[model samples]
Target: MIEIDSRAFGNKIKNIRNSKHFSLRQVSNQSKDETGVAISPSYWSLVERGKRNIPKPQTLKRIAKGLRVDESDVFRMAGLEAPTEATNLTRITSSEMVSVPIIGEIACGEPITAIENVSGHMLLPNNLVKGGDYFILKCIGKSMEPTIMNDSNVLVRAQPDVENGQIAAVLLDDDTTATLKRIKKTKNSVILMPDNPDFEPIVLNEDKPGRIIGVVKMEMKMF
Candidate 1:
């Protein structure tokens, strides 16, 4: 097994994060908002400063996306030449922080308010969850299965809008309901799609009415 010095790995990640002109919080936010994974600014700071080593493959993928590089790059920076070495872990803190649950989005059949009532859930270990601003949500159906599995935990942010091709939590004109779906906006209308093939598409006439909450940050599953 290849030994990865935590400090060296942290330094490389820090260098890339800085070169990208992105703050630790900023990257953490994006990971939660776009990919449905969560990370904190403080932990990211430590990871970049060579004070920590990452062990999860999913997390590496999120960091890779956040950094706009291939997944292998994260390993290379961490001083690992193989995927197996990436699993060797280390920590910066003894006590782990908590990440709350977020459960709302486009194509989601549940009421938005229903998901909000859940209390602050301290799940992922400090080493795994990474410290940051994040919330978790429950997935109801299989429309997003294979992409987002049923009974999965999704992380989300609170924002008023999103760009094209991003998954969002949308509120239809029906005041009592909400849906979680991927959105594509055109000049005439908004296209709402379900990740699964069994479902049909929903078109929102821009001239009519609709609301967009934040984008989907992360999707997690518990075995």
Candidate 2:
């Protein structure tokens, strides 16, 4: 049993949970229903935030089952090797998938209304999208490169706000245009930071007219 850093392990679990688009309540409910284990959301939150060590093996198995990921993978993420039998655990599959519309292209430069046109649709795994109204936008500039490249399709969850340091699709100048950028907030202004250092950050007054259209949840690269 390799020792795992509680904080690092917790962050890994948090990232996986978010990528799966699962809420703490959902995980807890599902785990209880499926595995007969009742892990509270508060305890899970503590586990995810590094306030607690990894749970016991049985509890970890229940958690893995609840998250719909391989038990072995969960153990591995915690810096422990799974028993040989655990490696053979079956994969989890959801009965339904979510369909997200691929909207028009969004400018990583001057900002364009990317949702004005519908290009096509994408079928995403139910676990990947959960329950939000999601849309896809094609990237049109290199300013967000190395993370969101030009021509890549980005999945955005329809929301009006995002936490600081999260990427969002922002509607600017009276909803006429939109851009994809990482959001940072100061007391006086909202800063749109580009991933590529070559691009300068765009700062708007806190009382600016722009609104957050949605948060960039995930990106799909175009081959």
Task: State the lDDT of candidate 2 residue by residue for 141-191, as single tens digits.
Answer: 877764566766788888988999899998776565678999999898889
TM-score list, all predictions: 0.47, 0.51
lDDT of 1 by residue, 1-223 (tens): 3577878777777788789886676576555524355677777777776666565666676677556576778867655564553464545353564555544442344444345444445455554455334556566776664456566666656567888877776677754345668888788888888876798878888565777755676665443
Assess candidate 1 and give its TM-score to the true structure.
0.47
**Clash number for candidate 1:** 25
- Candidate 1's C-alpha runs over 4 A off are 1-96, 102-116, 124-133, 173-176, 206-208
Top-scoring candidate (TM-score): 2
| Distance from true location, Cα of 191 in model 1, Å | 1.4
Show the lowest summed lDDT stretch of 10 residues, model 2.
105-114
